[model samples]
Target: MASAVKVLLIDDASLIRRLLGRVLNQDPLIEVVGEAENGQEGVELARTLQPQVIILDIEMPVMNGMEALPLLKKAAPKARIIMFSTLTESGARATLDALSAGADDYVTKPSNTGSFAATAGQINKQLAPMIKALAASATTYPSIRPHAEPKAAQQTVPDADHSWLTVTSDGAPEIVVVGVSTGGPQALQTFVPALPADLEVPVLIVQHMPAMFTRLLAERLDAQSAVKVGEATNGQVVKPGEVWFAPGGEHMYVTRQGENIVLTTDTAPPVNECRPAVDPLFESAVENFGSRVLGVMLTGMGNDGLAGSRLIKSVDGYVIVQDQASSVVWGMPGMVAKADLADQILPLNEIAPRVVDLLSTPRNRK
Candidate 1:
């Protein structure tokens, strides 16, 4: 049998540590190796234990998760860190910050359901699978991807090797739709900024996250990216040179109103077990733009975007996915690739330039 995944729990609350330890230990595939009450202790224990996974809490005395993050990385470079955050606004902001700062993923603390069993259930549901997934990739993929260069230095010039760009039977894309989860925040940081500021088509994105996190993600991307980025609003008009993300806990789709395409969000039932799932966003983009849509699937878990990719290809719309080498988790992109749905499977860094190339080409729009 395979060895159990080693896990370390770090939180200020003794209850949280105890709960995590007990819950995680119940799994024969996971072993709780150590526990710490603060970031300082966590760092020390991480260095000594060299656990495969570290569950870190954001708010703690002596050393908060943010403060200890870099130190933990330095101490145990191979371990994947998952942040423990609350479900509130501040927690959401801090979780985004942690993801950007090199944490692999995060799980929000259970809300005040006033039942210990419910809290434990929530933790097991959210954290256990994530721990296994992250640990599985720990030795294979780096905890943090290497930082990419600015847009000017990293431009992809097409050559004979780039023959895959001719697959689009549809006209040039009128709109770009992206579906990503898992390591999406970091991947977006690499992909979005590379887009030209004067892009002629608007970009729509669906990143699986909670309510406040999606808004914060939009704000952070907006601050760094040349293109305008904002969270999608129900009646917001979609325009070129701007990017909008689907609001969390809502399914965002596009609707054409006379001469304009507007983004619409609804509290519709979750698809693929995710509220802001990629499939809905991709399907909506195809509905509004027809064969003029470009579907880009970045690194994420699950096959949420598979059905949408199929629809995009049925109409000869182009679909590209981030290759496995550049993906933190290959589940989503892999599914599309395995089913032979993607037109091209490019690395994360190459996707932006390919997108630009496809958009710039003329199409036989009838």
Candidate 2:
């Protein structure tokens, strides 16, 4: 039998603790080994118990999640820390700060206390799966490679595996579409900075995040990157040298407007259970750029990009995916690779260069 994953719940609210415990204990694979009402106690328990995972609340008494994050890591290096944050502007900022401080991933707490059953369902549907996956990664440490270049990629990576996909067609890539989740914040921290300042292709990204979180993520990435980055606005012109992000709670797409490519956003129904799904952006790229789109599927859960990549492949558009070793959860990329659709399977470090290399390939299609 698979051993239960030991989890420590650290939240300031007793109600939240009790509710979360109720939801988590129901899962046979997860065992709530301990509980703490503040960060200081959480840190102490972490050092002593050394559980496989920690669901850390960002806002807590005695010591908030952000302040206690580094210290907790020092105490329990092996425990994967998942931040619990409210769906607010300040909460989003704290969540990003926690990620910078080395927290593994984050999950949004219930918006309000008005709904219990629905909130519990969210915990079950979202938080439980996240805990299970993180614990699995902790048990199976091979998902992280210790020797990867650039500091951010050194954690949670597998052995390097790649293949340069080839296609026989004449197409000029005008834009790059990126999709990532799970380890996305850290992954983008490195990958975006690696991109050349004079990058010719306009980059659009969809990172599974909430409304304010996407804006904060863009700001963080832009601060470190040579290429300018920002949240995508409705009907903005898609130009070179800047990376645009699909704002959370909306779907972003691009259309050719005479001499310019115009970007647009919509609150369309969630696709593949995600507000800003990769398929729509990838499909939009096909509509405007045809076989010249470069679709990149990064570390994320589920198969959001499979259908999009299939469409891209059918039109001879190139698709590059993050290798398993470099992914926190290789679900998105793995799905495309399983279908034999990816043209290049690369580590995070190699993806930007490969994009630059492909951009330099002269269009000679007949």
Q: How many clashing pairs per prediction, in order?
A: 0, 7
Task: Quantify all predictions' global Cα lDDT against the true fold.
Answer: 0.83, 0.82
Task: Note the residue pairs that clash in candidate 2.
Answer: 143-157, 144-156, 144-157, 145-157, 158-325, 165-343, 170-365
> Which sections of candidate 1 miss by over 4 Å?
138-168, 362-366
Question: What is candidate 2's lDDT per residue for 1-366, written digit by digit as tens?
Answer: 898889999999998888888888988999999999999999999999998889999877889898889989999998889999988889889898888778889999886655778878999889998888877753332333222221111111123121222333465688899988888898888788888888887999999898989999999889988999999999898678889999998999988989998889999999999988888988788767766788888988788878777767766777788888787777788777777677667888988887887787735211
Misplaced by over 4 Å in model 2 are 138-168, 362-366
Residues 1-366, candidate 1: write the lDDT tens digits: 879999989999987777788888998999999999999999999999999999999999999999999999999998989989998899988998999999988888877535779877887778888888777753443222222311111112122132222233545788899999888999999999898899989999999898989889999989898999999999999888999999989999987899898999999999998898988888777666766888999988778998888777755677888987888778788787776677777889999988888788735211
lDDT, residue 143, candidate 1: 27
In candidate 1, which residue pairs clash? Answer: none
